[model samples]
Target: MSKFDKALTAIEETVNGALLLSATLLLFINVILRYVFTSSTTWAEEAIRYAIVWVTFFGASLCARNKMHVGIDIFIQMAPPLIKKCLLAFAQLTAAFFTAFITYFGWVSTELVIETAQKSPAMLMPMWIVYISMPLGSALMTIRFVAAAVAILRDKTTGAEVKNEDAVDISRL
Candidate 1:
């Protein structure tokens, strides 16, 4: 990978890992406090919830970058090379469009929350900070999708087969 790609991957992986670890640790400590100490942090649950939401959104972008999202490619695999290429291109473009749509609407929602000055109940953090995840994640996914589409079309035009990262091995299964 190029330096920029490596850096982006590192950032995505680091953020996802840190958030997941923090959420798990916080939950474990909260459980211990609730049972043994008979006291718990009021903000723990809310923090965990928001952490999970961010993790999920960021994870989706990570998945898009790795092409790890679930897909049923039985038909595409069976199709002729030309048809398969067309199908793959179509799928990628469609996904790009969907993610772009989400990014646009998500930003709008985040802006509205910002204007309202909404705060999260427990942490009192600006609601826009949390709400912005949708746009940010979808924007990343949109870029990935567009890149995939370009790669697919380019490879197809050059008589190369498109390769998916998560291709299933039936014999192993």
Candidate 2:
């Protein structure tokens, strides 16, 4: 990865972690206050909801980078090597196209939300800030898919390596 890509990934990870931590802490504190002192943070639920939305979008990009999206592997697992490569490539292409589609539509939706000037109820945050995550995450996912496709094509990687990190024993499932 280039320095820029590395930095972008680091930022994503850090932000994801921070959002999760803050949400967890806030929710915990709110719960304790409510039970112990009959007090609650009005914004806690809303903040956690927004944080979850951001986490989902950001996590989608991270999942794309790692090629961890769930996919049916039975056919590819049984196919010949060349066919497996072709199938995997086609799958990646389809994924890229879908992510690009999401990116375009997401941006359009974000623009519309911005024009409406709507805000969240509790935080009064511009709705665009939350909606913006869709396009950003979709764009990142698109880039990751395209890059994976390029690498698989240029290096002639087998699809088997795609799930190498997820070495689960099916008997347990």
Model 1 stretches with alpha carbons more than 4 Å out: 156-160, 164-173
Model 1 lDDT tens row, 52-169: 8888888998898788877788777667678888888888889999999999999999999999999999999899988998998898889788887787787736323556556764
Candidate 1, residue 10: lDDT: 83
Residue 63 local lDDT, model 2: 91
Tens-digit per-residue lDDT, 22-41, candidate 2: 99999999999999999998
Separate clash counts for every candidate: 0, 0
Candidate 2 residue pairs that clash: none
Which candidate's lDDT is highest? 1
Native-vs-model 1 lDDT? 0.85
Provide TM-scores for the models.
Answer: 0.89, 0.88
Q: What ranges in model 2 sit over 4 Å off?
A: 156-173
